[model samples]
Target chain A: MDCISARSKNIKGKGQSKLKRRESLAGLLFVSPTIIYFIVFFLLPLAVCIYASFTNWNILSPNRVFVGTLNYERLFVDPKFWKALKNTLFMLIPIPIYITFALLFAYACHKNILGQKVFRAIYYLPYISSIVALTLIWMWLFNSKYGLVNNFLSLFVDNPPSWLSDPFWTKWMIVIMISWKLIGFTSIYYIAALKSIPKSYYEAAQIDGAGPRQQFFKITLPLLTPTTFYLLVIGMIGSLQTFVEVQMFAPDGGRGYGVGTIVFYIWQKAFSSSQMGYACAIATVFGLFILVITVIQFTLSRKWVFEGN
Target chain B: MKRKISPVRIIVFIILLIGAVTMIVPFAWMLSTSLKEANLVYTIPPQWIPKPVDWKNYIEIWTASNLLTGIKNSCIISVSVLVFCTFTSSMAAFAFSKLSFPFKNAIFVMLLTTIMVPLVVLLVPLFVIYTKIGWIDTLLPMIVPASMCNINIIFFLRQYMTGLPKELLDAAKIDGCGYFSAYWRIYLPLCKPAIVANVIMLFMITWNDYFGPLVFTHSESKQNIQVAIAMLNSHYIQQTDIPLMMTASLIAILPVLILFIICQKYFTESFAMTGIKG
Candidate 1:
């Protein structure tokens, strides 16, 4: 009765109060589930990770010990941290080359040359296969004594290097496996980007007497700036989180932190060592590290990522 | 991608062909070795062909242990995850793309921000929470997380939705369809390609992932196929005179590869929506 009277009185104001409040209420109700989920799952978990970094909270523990800055202090001095950081950097080295190959692969398929569908399916196999299985296969393939790679090399080179066993070779092996897995999906992305570039652009360039080489450089490359920029940002972020390949492939807990990329190192600390506090700290730092890079990438993309419009 | 199809273009094709072959060999090798005798697996030049092809590996692996049970467990987990993720994400995508929700931009931004937080960062803390809920060693930990709509998937559906003509939606509303009804009757059918891609991608992730399955499952009966394959040394890889490991690997990757092959077209298209399109 009170609500009815209020609405009826507000009717004198005209054209407003009858549906306005109800529409606002409906909108709130509609978005509530997703908002609740984000708060509980995404936001809360992040907060927990950040706070857990400051305190020693093991899964088995009865209570968290407030360790304060100790986790942070230990992370800085840890040589393993330095090695993992280096390994993480090395993992990113081949990404640009990988992206180039991806573009070539995409362009090939886009142009409809040479059993294109078959080729894309073939390229995409590794990406979709079980990573653990793929890593294990790579692990066996890199076997120093009897593996496929070394065995092939032995017909010419005397002592084919121990790819997984050695620290230096371990980095290369990880890079190769990572590249093999990602190239196809990324290629598909490039193929889509290529297709979106209408033929009119190329026709216009050709009429201006621009040959294929000149057309690619002047037209194709420039228009492709947005896609490439997107690839770089996502690719870098993805590569930095490269965990499973190292976790499974480079054995002996990934060779004394040699191939222990940031993620692998976190796994080592949290799961292997039971240093939950310090692991969370590493994860927190790593998150911030990635956050900074992504912010820079997004900022850069403002100037770099071109609008199709 | 340098230039036109010259003599160099032919050379590029050759190089790409070789690379593609290399990409596929691991899987082909996996399948072939599955049917071979164990002794032939490590032979010179890594035997491409096996003699007296032993097909018993599949039966031995499946029947000698609780692998069939594990396979069943994996299927249950993966299918459930797939259904939940697809349904929830499509709904979320609908809300983001169509409905005039309050603070939609803010919510979208918040969702996108999580993509930067690597899986590593979330794993430990999430582990802690799972342990609290006594979800360790059960499929719930893996299954539940799979439902938490990823930003990439939502954004993907959103982009595809954005490309769709708004008139279809407006016309539905004019004929008295509400938001959910229009989404169900209109967008659902039109977005079939994108939805299929999303399902295939998520299904592949769940089906092939050893990471979550490794942590969440422990018993051989609870193990997924990848874990089963990787832990070959324990299961049957050590059993000489059989190609059991190979058989398991082949069985493990078959479903996902088949799905990927089936959805290859849509996968390529919707994947482009994510990035790399001009």
Candidate 2:
């Protein structure tokens, strides 16, 4: 019996090791499909965008000329570039306002008050809803002559301004629409972050004579710093890459370069103007900008986003 | 001090309720407009309630705009992509979580870094490649890329898998199960929530993605709902029969919304997971 057991031990050991190796190999094999897919679709295209950045390759023209930094030069001198930057910033400025509101909404939800779930679902529907639907609704709602928003506003003032027609109001309407769409998603993050803080802390705060406002400022806000940092990083990236909404809203936008972000500008240059090289340069610069901003944010996050300490 | 559920709170709720109503009203308006007579849709001091319903516009768009074909194309593409992406990712995730792979960390890091690469950069090159391969119009671009060892899915499932009990897997192995058997029987069933969340996210993404459809698909018959609807309202939105366009847009969004409503917990959890994990 002892001899039989010993023989089985050695056989089992060898078999198991072999199985492990095979399993690992199979795992690698399974993932290779994805790696290859990424290489062909993502990495190769990325390489082209980089290479194209250094040349004047337009899809329209057969012949391509090498031009280093000329596209960058053109971007710097162009007023449209600044306008695009301004438009992006203009859109971004409202994020903090909405985020503050989201935090409040999340706090209200976290309180587990009456009808919390209903409020949550109501607010959150817009976030998950197709942007196409949201945009269409907003377009109708913003109609100059007869729209819901204007009609609602007319109740207060004798005449409601033509929001869609006016250039100044058009971007603001877009920002308002985007922010409303975003707040629910943002609020959920805060709610999650809020939920994670052991209830004991808040209970203890209450014992220590901390009021609602005091607890919020001292405990809730500080703990949510990490969430805020994360949201900011993602928000900046999304705002920078804000393309589709602008494309739909400002198809025939006003003046030079129209009301667009850097991404929109790149889209126009690449697809519309057929200046692949110029677009690539814009992409490179945008990528660099994102990199720098991200680095600074992560560095700054050390002070506020306390993962452990 | 801010009031808690007082008259002020009631007032605030009323205000926010109004806001929420405004937010939700569009869908109702879209539906009504779709049902209303075409002439009644554009009337001044606009008729909130029309005298007669017009099913003809819905019929017209469905038939004239090739919406059925568009919807069929969308369903085929989204479902296929979902299956492929889910299968490949879970298999890859099985390895990441349970098995000991050499050079695993390095490969994982490479995938993570690629997440930052702007998708726009891939546009021109993929266009050339797809055109060369004669896959420009077909659904290959959408499906092939949709399924694969998605880095996000891998990480998500990895985190979920690692948290699972080692005992379950060990017991399975002890019962004469191979690694694949243990993975299939033990791990995959446990990771249902992650799979559900991932599916919902992917559905929303693939369904709503305008760019990929715009570039890859040309014919209205081949296009997804997003592309098809865009073609309907592209050149001039206001000039179009506003009611019909709005209804079509609502219809386009309905599938994902229905999915989301059913899986609200997963959707919320997914968003929460991103924050916590990131």
Candidate 3:
């Protein structure tokens, strides 16, 4: 009986090992496509991108002569690059504004307001709609002469300022457009965050003699920090990469560098001018900047984002 | 208990109503303009309703530009990418969530990090590579890379799959069902809701994607709906054919808008799910 039991145990152990191997093989097989894809598209392209940045590679030119940090040097001095960076940074001004509105809207809708569902759907419309369509609609609406915006503004002020043409207003127009596009989407996230906060917390706050304002500040806002931080990080990254709207609104970077984003500049350098190496260098720097910003946001999030224990 | 109609609720409702109007007015204007004749577009008051609603622009847009071809190209690209990527991503997600393998977590984490790498960084290198491969002016550039796998979709689906019962797959395995069969027959059916959510999201994204098509396709025929609309905008802007432009814009947005409305529940719910967990 002892020998038979021992033989059975050995058989079971061998079977288990074989099953484990099969599982491993299957897992790898399942993931193989993704692995191969990442290597070919992501890893290879990234490697080539970094390597090509050091060379004076131009699409028009045959030779990709090694120019070691020269492209970087030129990028740092390029006025268009600086202006583009400034415009990109300047667009971030509306982040807080839109976030505040989004939060407020979320808070309002969270109260189970009448037509809340409809309101939510309406807000999400601009976000899901074609950016090209939205941009064109906005362009027509801001068309200085016939635009509804200027038409309405004319009733109030003598001059509404050429929204698309005037440098100063063009930035604001982009800002308005971005804010309009983002608010609903951001609010949806905020609503989700709001939902996840326990009803007991708000009840506890009420028991502590906290007013609506106090409850919001003390309990609600703190709980919502993680969502806020997430939005901020993504918003910052997205603002830095702003392109389509800028491209459409001011095709030539607007008058005196009004709306050229970092991506737009990189695009122009790479595709328009065929300065592949220079574009790669700009892209590398821009990518690093995004990385650093993301890292910083992550690090900072640890301090502010309330991890509900 | 009869709840009182509070002033606060009223105030909030009023504010939301105003905000909703602001959100909706642009679309309203787009529709209104699309129905107006070109000569009537620049009126002083800006007619909320055109005097004679012209449906001619709608009919004319088909012949006016590459709108029909644009729609076809967009449909091809969006549908193919979503279907193929959804399968690959779900498969990856299944492996990551349920299966045990050496370096699985490490691989997933590495893939997660790649999400942070912006598309711009890869633009130049990809363009060069595509040029070398003669993929320029073709839909392959847009279709191939995306169809490989989407990291976000994989990540989301993994989160979802982790919530599913392990015993189901165990039972299937015990019944002599292979790993692939378990995934396809049991897990895939159970993952319907999540898959539907993901499909809607992916469709919207791929449909609205302009930058990818803009950079990849140079020819008029190869252009996606967004790029085609943009080209139309540039051309028509010179002619000041605002009505025609509006008609084109409306046509471009209609498909996605209809999809969004039909799948409204999934759209908002998916956003909430991903945003919170993410």
Candidate 4:
């Protein structure tokens, strides 16, 4: 009886192992496509980009000759690179402004006011619409002479700034356009965050004689830090990569003026001038810069972001 | 007793009203301009409503630009990529969530890292690779890479699948169902809500993509809607044909606007999910 029981147990063990092996095989088969795709498209391209950045791999040239760090060395001193970086940083000015508006709008809507749904949808409209279409509409709206914006400004001032042509006003136009596009979408996120905060906290604050402003600063603001940090990180990354609007607004890479973002400059160099190697160098540095900034944001967020359930 | 209206509430209402108007004026202007004759576009008061509402610009856009072909190309790219990507991502999600595999965590982590790497970094290398393969002007460059897998969809689906009851799939296996059949017959049906939310998000991103289509395709025949709109803008700006440009912009925005209105719930819900969970 004991021998028979041992043999049965041994057979059961073998059968279970076979089933596990079959499951493993199926799992590997399922993920094979994704693995192959990453290997070919993502990993391979990344390796090639890093390698080519160190060499002179011009698209028009017959051969790519190795020139160690020459591209990187030139990129460090390139005035165009610095100007593009500056413009990209300048684009970040709207992040705080839009986030503030988003928070306010979100707070107002959270009060369950009438027409809340309509307001939410209307705000998110610019975000969903095609950037090209919106940029064109903005260009028309900011038309120096006949634009509705300038026409309105002329009601108060002797002369409105040439929003599209004048370098200074052009920057403000881009900022305004960006803020308008982002505010609604950012508000959606804020609304979600606001919804997640417990009403008990506010009720507690009210019992403690906290005014609306005190309740907001004491309870609401602290709870919303996580959402704010998330938006800030995302907004920073997006600002650093601003391209389409810059390209659409100033097709010449904002040549004499300083309106070109980093991605715009990279696109111009890589595609337009065929400076593939140098563009790769700029791109590599930019990517690393983003990675570093993101890491720093995450680290700094620990100090302020609320981690409560 | 009737509740009294607070001064603060009234102030908030007025502020929201102003904000809503600011958000909508551009779109209202776009529609107004599209209905205006070319000469009336630059009128001094910037006609909020055209003197005589002309629909000629709307009719002229089809023949004057590559709008038709752009729509066709965009549809093809968006549809093909979404269909293939949805299938592969779900399958991968199923495996990651339910099945046991070797080095699965390592592979997933590697895939997640790709999300952090910006597309601009890959531009030079990808452009080079496409040029070498004579795919610079082809839709294949835009379609193929994206169709392989969407990491975001896979990640979202995996999180969703993990929340589903394990006994559901185990019961299917006991009934002699293969792993693929369990995924298809059981998990896929159960995962519909999550999949729909992801599909809507993917559709929006793929449809609204400007940079990918812009960089990959050069020819007028091959251009997508966004690029086509851009081309029309640059081409007509020299002639200052603002009305025609407005008409084209309206046409380009209409499909997305319609989709957003129809799938409004899924759109906001998916965004909220990503924001909070991410």
Candidate 5:
């Protein structure tokens, strides 16, 4: 009887082991396509990009010769690169302003105010619209002669700036265009973050004799830090990569080449100039910049963003 | 529950009212310009409502260029990307969430790392790779690369699937259902809302993308609506037919507006989830 029972137990153990093997096999099979895709698109391209950054190969070049960081050295001295970098960084000036407005709008909406849903939908409109179309509309709106912006401004000021043509206001125009589109999206995110904050906190604060103003500064602002950090990082990354809007508004980079962003510069270099190697070098630097900034932001976020409360 | 309207409430309402109008003016203006005659576009005081509205600009722009073909191509590319991406990402998400495998954490971390790599860095390399594969000027560059694996989508879906009952999957296994079959017959059906929400978001991203189509697609017929409009913008600027350009711009955004209106909830919800997690 002991020998028979032991034999049955061994057979059952084998069956369970077979099932485990099958499950492992199934897991690999399920994830294989994504794994293959990542290798081909993400991994392979990244490796090639890093390598190509050190080479002097054009689009149709038969041979690639290693340049030993020549592209990187030249990039630092290149006026166009500096200009592009400046333009990229300049686009981020509106973040604080955008976040403030978004917070106020979100707070107002979160109050269960009149036309709350309508306000939310209206604010989010530009975010969902095609950027190309919106950029085009803004181009018309910034037209020196008949633009709605100038038309409205003309009523007060004798001379309203030519928003698109003038290099002076080009960055400002780009900032406004980006902020207009992003405000709604930012507000929506803020609203979501606000909703996740428990109401009991506010009730407790009120019982402790906190005024509405005090409640906003102490309770609301502190709690919303995570969302702010998120928006800041995302906003910075996006601003640094400003391309399509800049390209659309100023196809030639506008007067004195003021509106040329880093990504747009990269695009022009690669596609138009066919300087693939140089473009790759710029892209590599740009990518590293983004990654480092993101990492720093992540490291620093713990100081401000409340983890539990 | 009724309370008197405070002055602060009135102030907030006024501020929101102004903000709402500012938000909407662009679309309203785009639509108004689409209806305006060429001469009416540059009036001394721009006409908010165009007199003797010309609806012909829409038909004219459509027939004049590759606008319709661009729309068709956009639909084809986005839908394909949507279907394939959703399927593959969900499968990957399922593996990450449900199944135990060797080096799973390492692979996931590797995947997350790549999300920080800018697409700009990949552009030159991808162009070369695609050219080598003879995919330049083809839709494959746009569709295949995007459909490969969206890190964001995989992460989102995995977070979602983690909350699902593991017992259901176990029950399927006990009922003689294999892993793939269980995922197909049970999880896919159960995750329909999530899948649909992801589809809308992916569709929007794909459709609104201008750069991929601009670089990868050389032929006119292969271009999407955003690319088509951009090409037309430069041409129409020289053509000096502002109304035609405006008309094209309006048409380019129509699908997005319609989709957003229809699926605003899903859109906001998806964004909310992304924000909270990220």
Candidate 6:
């Protein structure tokens, strides 16, 4: 009887291992396509980019000479690169202000204000629209001569700044356009975050004689930190990569280097100038900047981003 | 309990109203300008409403530019990409969530890290590779790479699938269903909401993608609506026909606007889900 029990237990263990093996095979089979794709597109391209950053290879050239540290050194000294970096950083100014308004707008929508649904949908319209079309429309609106904005501004100011043409106002124009497009989309996220907050917390605050303002600061604000943190990171990364508006509005670096973003500068170097090596080097550095910033954001998020109880 | 019409609510309403107007004015201006003649566009007061609307600009622009062909190409490319990306991402998500595999965590982490590698970094090498493979001037470069996988979609679906019951797959397996069938019949059916959400999101990404088409396709006929519209400014830079540009912009945005309105619930809800889950 002891031998029989031991033999059955051994057979059961063998069957379980076989099942595990089959499951592993099945898993590999399921993920094979994605794995193949990642290898060909993601990994290979990344490998090529890293390699190309160290070489002087134009796209048309057959030979790529190894030039270690040369491209990186050039990037450090290049005034255009610095200007582009500054321009990219300049766009970060609106993010906090944008978040504040998005939060406030979301709060109002959460309270079920009149036409809340309609307003939310309307706000998301620009997000859905093509960036090219949106930029062109904005171009028309920012026209120095016949623009609706300037036309409106002429009613008070003697000289309205040329939004698209003027170097100083070019970054501001892009900022305004970016803000307009993102406000609706970001606010919707905040609205969802606000709604997810348990009503019981607000009720508890009220029971403790907390006013609406007190409830907001003490309860709602704390709860919304995770969402805010998410937006802040996303917003910063996105602003750093601002391209279409700046590219379309200020095609030639916006009348004396007002709106040349890092990506746009990279595109100009690689595509227009055919300086593929320099572009790759710039791209590598820009990517590292984004990575560093993102890592810092993640590290900082631990302090303020509320982990739900 | 009856809620009072508080002054705070009134203030909120006014603020939101102002925002709504700001949002709507661009489209309104586009429409207004598209109807006005070239000379009438630069009026002092700015014609909020055109005296004599010129619908000819739309007709003329549509006939002259690659607008119609662009629309057709954009629809085909975006739809194909949408379907392919959704399928591949979902399948991968299923494996990650349900199946027991060796080195699964390591593989997923590797894939996630690739998201940090921005598209701009890949631009030069991809351009060189595409040129080598003779994919430049073709839609294949744009469609094929984008279709293969999207990290965000996989992450989203994986997060969703993790919340699902393990017993469902177990029950299916107990009923003599194979792993593929479990995925196809059980998991796929259960994943409709997620799939719809992914579809809408992918549609927006593919449709709004200007940079890809612009870089890849050089031919006039192969260009998407965005490229076509952008070409309008370049080709007619000296002319500066604002009305024609506005008309083209209107046409370009119409499909997305209609789709957004129709899928309003899914569009908003999907974005909302991403924010919370992400």
Q: Score the docking of each candidate (DockQ).
A: 0.51, 0.54, 0.82, 0.76, 0.75, 0.75
* CAPRI-style docking class of model 1 based on DockQ: medium
DockQ of 2: 0.54
When superposed on Cα atoms, how far off is each prediction in RMSD?
4.0, 3.3, 1.3, 1.7, 1.6, 1.6
Worst 10 residues of 6 chain A by lDDT: A249-258
Sorted by DockQ (best first), the order is 3, 4, 6, 5, 2, 1
Q: Which of the CAPRI classes, incorrect, acceptable, medium or high, describes model 4?
A: medium
User: In model 6, how well does chain A match by TM-score?
Assistant: 0.96
**Under CAPRI classification, how is model 3 graded?**
high
The reply for model 3, stretches above 4 Å from the true place, is A1-3, B1-3, B235-237
Fnat, model 5, is 0.76
TM-score: model 3 vs. ground truth: 0.98
Candidate 1, residue B250: how far the Cα is off, in Å: 1.3
- Write down the lDDT of every candidate, Cα atoms only: 0.76, 0.78, 0.90, 0.88, 0.86, 0.86
TM-score of chain A of each: 0.88, 0.89, 0.97, 0.96, 0.95, 0.96
Fill in the DockQ of model 1.
Answer: 0.51
lDDT of 3 by residue, A144-180 (tens): 9989999999999998899887877888998899899
Q: Per-residue CA lDDT of candidate 2, range A1-309, in tens?
A: 999999999999999898788867867776777678768777788888888888898877778888887888987887877888788777786679778878877877786545668788888888887776677777777787777777778779987877765656778888888888888889989999888888898899999999978988988888888889888988887777777677776775544544677777777877788888888887877778777888899998887786756
Per-residue lDDT of candidate 3, residues B22-118 (tens digit): 9999999999999998899978888899999999999999998789999999999998999899999999999999999888988988898787989
Best by DockQ: 3
lDDT of 4 by residue, B166-230 (tens): 99878988999999999999999998988888888887788788998889888998999889889
Colliding residue pairs in candidate 6: none
Output the number of the lDDT-best candidate: 3
How would you encode candidate 4's per-residue C-alpha lDDT over A1-309 as one tens digit per residue?
999999999999999999999999999999988998899888888999899899998999879899999999998899888988888889989999999999999998888776789989998999988899999999988888888888899999998998766666777888998899999999989999999888899888888899989988989999999899989988988887888888888887554757888898889999999989988999999999999999999999999999886
Task: Supply the DockQ value of model 3.
Answer: 0.82
The lowest-lDDT stretch of 10 consecutive residues in candidate 3 chain B is B231-240
